[model samples]
Target: MANNKSAKKRILTNERNRLQNRFYKSSVRTLTKMFLNSLEIYKTTRTPENKEKVQNTLNSAYSLIDKATKKNVFHKNTAARKKSKLAAQFKTA
Candidate 1:
């Protein structure tokens, strides 16, 4: 338990930040999954439309990752690593 007003306020603030961070992290994961799925579809189908879809999802995932990094939810190195992996997968496909 918090012993003082400031401590209590800090606890509340921390909880709020935790929730926001969790939302960003989960959203990033979801977007990454969507990107991978689209990439898989593109690999199997080899259609221009599927390639475009993959590109769109990749862009969205990259955007979210950058935003999360900017918000301090993700470290810049972590964000860069994730983006690199995604890009590598895209290139290989």
Candidate 2:
């Protein structure tokens, strides 16, 4: 428990930051899933429209992952790994 005023304030601030981080993290995951699903659809069709959708998915996924890394929610290496995997999936799709 926080006894001092400053400590109580710190606890509140931490809670707020935690919620914000959680939101960002969940959003990232959701975007990533959307990208993956788009890629899967692109795999079967291979039309220009599907390709454009795949590209957009890749771009959005990259942006969110990079943002998460920048905010320190994910490690730089972890982000790199994820980006690489996404790229590989895109290529094969």
Candidate 3:
């Protein structure tokens, strides 16, 4: 238990932030998975449709990661690393 009022408020704020961070983390994971799946499909099918889909997925994932980084949910360097890895995957495929 928090002995002080400010400490109690801090605990409440921390809990809220934790929940919000969890949501962002989950969303990021889902978006990354979607992008990876698109890349895999593109690799196997090699169709123009798949290419476009993969590109769109990659762009969306990148955008979301940037947002997360801006919100402090993710570190800037971590976001950059993820974006770079995604771009490399697209390039290789």
Candidate 4:
């Protein structure tokens, strides 16, 4: 329990931040999964349309990740590592 008014406000603020962070993290994961799935489809089909889809998903994932990093939801190095991993997978595919 919070002992004072300030403490109560702090608790509420922290909870709001936590939920926002969770939303960002979840969105990042969803976008990453979408990118990977599209990459897989491209690998299987080797079609220009599939390749374009993969590229678009990759760009979207990258944009969301950068936004999360800018908002301080993700550490800069962590964001870099994630982006690197995604890029590597795309290249290999």
Candidate 5:
């Protein structure tokens, strides 16, 4: 247990930051999955609307990933690698 006032406050702050980090990480994963799913749909259907959806998904994923990196939830190169892999998936699909 935290015996001092500062230590208690630190514990609370850590919990808050942990929750915030969790949110950003979950957002990154959700956005990435959304992009991949949209890509799969585009592959199967090959329609303009599906293509547009895929593009939008990719854009949103990129934005969220960059935000996560900026927030220090992810490293810069890790973000770049993730973005590259996502784009690669899109290309191969």
Candidate 6:
């Protein structure tokens, strides 16, 4: 329990930030899953449609991660690593 006014405000702010961070994390995971699924479909089908979908998903995921890093939801190196891994997946596919 926060007895002081400032402490109460801090607690409220922390809750707000926590929610925002959770949203960012959940979105990133969802995007990553979508991208991976697209990769799998592309692997089996090898169609231009699948390639385009994969590219679009990758771009979206990359954009989100970079933005998250900038907003401090993710660390810079972590974002870089994720971006690198995603690019590698596309290349290998």
**Which segments of candidate 4 are over 4 A away from where they belong?**
none
Candidate 2 lDDT over residue span 1-93, tens digit each: 989999999999899889878977898788889988888888878899988988997898899889988888889999999899988887776
Instruction: Please identify model 3 stretches exceeding 4 Å from their true place.
Output: none
The C-alpha stretches of model 6 lying farther than 4 A from their native spots are: none
Instruction: Point to the candidate with the largest lDDT.
Output: 6
Better of 1 and 5 by TM-score: 1
Candidate numbers sorted by TM-score from highest down: 6, 1, 4, 5, 3, 2
lDDT of each: 0.94, 0.87, 0.90, 0.94, 0.91, 0.95
Local accuracy of candidate 4 as per-residue lDDT tens digits, 17-87: 99989999999999988998888889889999999999999999999999999989999999999999999
lDDT by residue (tens digit), candidate 5, 7-76: 9999999999899899988998999888888887888899999999999999988998899898898999
TM-score of 2: 0.90
Could you tell me the TM-score of candidate 6?
A: 0.96
TM-scores for all candidates: the values are: 0.96, 0.90, 0.92, 0.95, 0.93, 0.96
Model 1, which residues run further than 4 Å from truth?
A: none
Q: What C-alpha lDDT, on a 0 to 100 scale, does residue 58 get in candidate 4?
A: 91
lDDT of 1 at 49: 93
- Model 4 residue pairs with clashes: none
Worst 10 residues of 1 by lDDT: 35-44
Across 1-93, the per-residue lDDT of candidate 6 in tens digits comes to 989999999999999999989988899999999999999999999989999999999999999998889889999999999999999999999
- The ten-residue window of minimal lDDT in model 5 covers 32-41
